[model samples]
Target: MKFYGIVVFLAFAAFAQGVPHNGRTKRSISDNLETLVESIQALASEVNEDLGIPAFDPFTDDSVAISINQTLAKLEGELTDLNIDGLSDFSIDTLKFTLIGLKFTFAFTWPNITFSTGYSIDGTVASILPIYGDGKASGEITNLAVSGTVAISVKNSYLYLKSMSSAVSLDDLDIQLSGLLNNDDASALIAAVISDTVPQILVDFQDVISDTVNTAVTEYVDDYLGSMTLAELLALIGS
Candidate 1:
């Protein structure tokens, strides 16, 4: 969600400074903003089709379990070697852990889930930056609320239940460390513990992640489309 917020900010920033440069045709700000709105609506639609129908399950065939371990191993190494400046009581050098093996069980019906509407986006004018590209052009997005109704009945859905091995990637991770513990080396300990534990935890919880993402995407899309600022058009990405 934080990442999404950042993306929204970037999109708006680009809109503000957008010009007919790089061989692109000129478009008014309103046109660009409307495009952004349409993109979101399209997102909702795609989420409904892809996730709602179970047409795309990254972990469906046990592929996730097998692939995630290697990524976890690399993360363990990187965190172990990470160097943080001004570290008096903590060092991110001691981080280490082995990823836990994972398995999944699913009883998915034809339409494993249903989304009644897609997500909604709203922000106060006050949250927008009066000036662009200066400081905090990362303008705040206010009232960015998302609401939807998702129905998931995997338990009642008659289908196959299975588990598999999988692997996940952790790319370009920007790690940050903070906090102090009673004049002690808490930060180092915390980083070490996290580096050791997070991978295993993620591997163990892959199934939950899959189901939650699926439900959230579809429900938000279904609920949001009804009130979308733009009408549904062709697919946003691949058609």
Candidate 2:
């Protein structure tokens, strides 16, 4: 759920002037943006290492807990001592930029994102299914897309992100929670229900997710932008 790749892209765009440039013909802004995108696509691992961002091919987090209660489905569960991995294994399908004056909008799609987590769930899955055990949960989201628009303004002769908005969507989701029930049949049934319901749950919480992403992205991007003057940013881009 962390758009760490996007953050890296923006960081590069803002500070690419530091990158050594070869003597070549002056390129248009669109061409420069394209180059930046290519650089990210080609050197994401190296760039992430340089920036101290952990590689996501299989990022691991040990401190995760979740409590789930769905009244309509008569399901209640709590997953504790969760360990999650593979949060960063995603491939970018497309990255498009639209620039108009000081406003920039980025539309991007991650075609494949997969993760696995191990936890202990203690609760009932359905009214009759007893979901109590240690288990592993895996999921994959396809064609996950996000579009964000950021408006930049100059304040006291420094660039800052003035306002931001974002949208999120996905093509499909598949989830499998296993080893939670004694009966294999019951476990499969619960996993099927989860796979069917998760997309809807995400839809219901789309606004919340967008808000969280917007706030986080704005704060992170602004910190870097604020430190540089408009002239400095322009010089970096031109370089």
Candidate 3:
């Protein structure tokens, strides 16, 4: 769990996976799941606010729009001269999305037991080349996916991720849960276990996108300008 306050990606389950906690104690499986997921979402919002270079503000903050637009325009120009092949043409329209922050939007569809969430770079333009960058440093990555499913035990709270490509069955779950009982940090660990079990693709997308979005925010925010050119530094140094 990357806990830097906000702008993060997290997915988990709340069940005991088969462990038997006859009576309730600190929290139920549902309680634990809610906490873990909520905390992660809170972290994303926090990071975005802390580090994200504000995009054009629809909310009365015109200064925000000007600053980021100038910043992204310069960055887009820099990358264009870099001769980086496969990059689309640099334009304010394109850079506008770069200037905009990818929102931490999430929704849970209970009936299917599928946790579906995605980051969208919201802007006035159509979606394309949605890289998380600021006016400073920018990077890109691919293959982002996110997904998780649940299996409830006969007892209600005992839960697990059905790793099977098809729907996970009851027998497969019981065998796994028996040993997990009496374990430490069992609730969190159990959630991670199911989370980790998520296929590489899903995990990769979730993680890569989170990083990409954060990197872009950091790049734009001027906080992580550790890589500014020596000449750029020297100019500041002589001052």
lDDT of 3: 0.25
Q: Please tell me which model should have the higher lDDT, number 1 or number 3.
A: 1
- Angstrom error of the Cα, residue 235, model 3: value is 51
Candidate 1 segments exceeding 4 Å error: 2-168, 171-176, 180-184, 227-231, 235-239
Q: Point to the candidate with the largest TM-score.
A: 2
lDDT for each residue of candidate 1 in 15-96, tens digit (9 for 90 to 100): 3332232235664333444454334323331233322322121111211111112212311111111111211111121111
Higher-TM-score candidate of 1 and 3: 1
lDDT of 2 by residue, 1-239 (tens): 23443555445553553444557766655455555655544444444545454433344456455444453233334444333333333444434434455666677677777777776656654356565766777778777777777788888898888888888887787887767665656777878877777667668777766676677777777777787787776566553
In candidate 3, what are the lDDT values of residues 1-239, reduced to their tens digit?
11111122112111111223336455443443344444333333222343332221111111212112322221111111111111111111110001012111222321111111111122221233232322221122222222222121111322222111111111111001211223334534543554444344333444443444444433332322233342332232221
Best by lDDT: 2
TM-score of each: 0.28, 0.67, 0.18
Clashing pairs in 2: 56-88
Clashes of 1: 23
Off by over 4 Å in 3: 1-9, 12-25, 48-107, 110-239
